[model samples]
Target: MLDEIVASRDAAGAALTAEVDAVIEAANAMSDRFRAGGRLLAFGRGEAAADAAHVAVEFTHPVIVGKRALPALCLGGEPALLGMWGRPQDIAVGICPATGDLAAARSLGLLTVALTANEEFPEADHVLCARSADPLVAREIHITVYHLLWELVHVFQEAE
Candidate 1:
């Protein structure tokens, strides 16, 4: 049991480490959008919907003291409403997206991000794959990725 737990943690760490550069790039872009008056809109289906809500809360109500609360909304995985509310400078985040919503958001001029366990996720401005076959492990990885994004977005803003 201990070995399995360690392996899962290691896998998630390796996946994130491999994608560190991508995360940093995405964070920089996200920071730019926020600076230009963009809000973050997160969505997902089924179990992932909970994660979307969590992301929204994390941004809108920062857990860390001194971290500014950013504007964010959870769309409950509604694709149509994303189009309705998304603006040119807003950020669209899709959790375990299985639809073309991210691509659609991109077309609408919003910066799009997709977090998934699928080997082939739909095209988006930023796609972060958890690289785990197990759903539990993937979920863990996805959670970490979003936390990193939330933290790094602030880091970029502070640096500027």
Candidate 2:
């Protein structure tokens, strides 16, 4: 069982490395918005909704050193609320659902990040494709990805 977890981690790491560049770019964009006094809004459906909230909590209340608190919130799987709350400077992260309409409004200018499976592609400024087939593995990878995002966004935040 331990080996399984280790192997999954190894695979996830490799996959992440392959997409690191795109991740960096998106993080920088997110940081720019944050620096401009924008907020982090995370949304997803079903189980992913909970994950979105978790990500929001981590950002709003950092557990790490040198990472100041940032404005963040979870939409609790509700995309419609975004219509009212989302701004051109905010960043929206959709965990596992279609966000095609999330940024359809041309002037919304919301930096959108969509993490999903290959078959579930959607319109997003950044699309992070998950590499795991098992739900457990996928969840683990998702956690790792968001953790990295939180960390890197701070790095870019410091730059600005």
Tens-place lDDT per residue, model 1, 23-86, is 9988899999999999999998779999999999999999999999999999986856778899
Q: List the global CA lDDT of all models.
A: 0.89, 0.81
Candidate 1 lDDT at 92 equals: 94
TM-score for each candidate, following the candidate numbering = 0.93, 0.87
Candidate 1, residue 124: how far the Cα is off, in Å: 0.4
TM-score of 1: 0.93
Q: Per model, how many backbone clashes are there?
A: 0, 0
lDDT comparing candidate 1 with the true structure = 0.89
> Best-fitting candidate, measured by TM-score?
1
Off by over 4 Å in 2: 1-9, 99-101, 104-107, 119-122
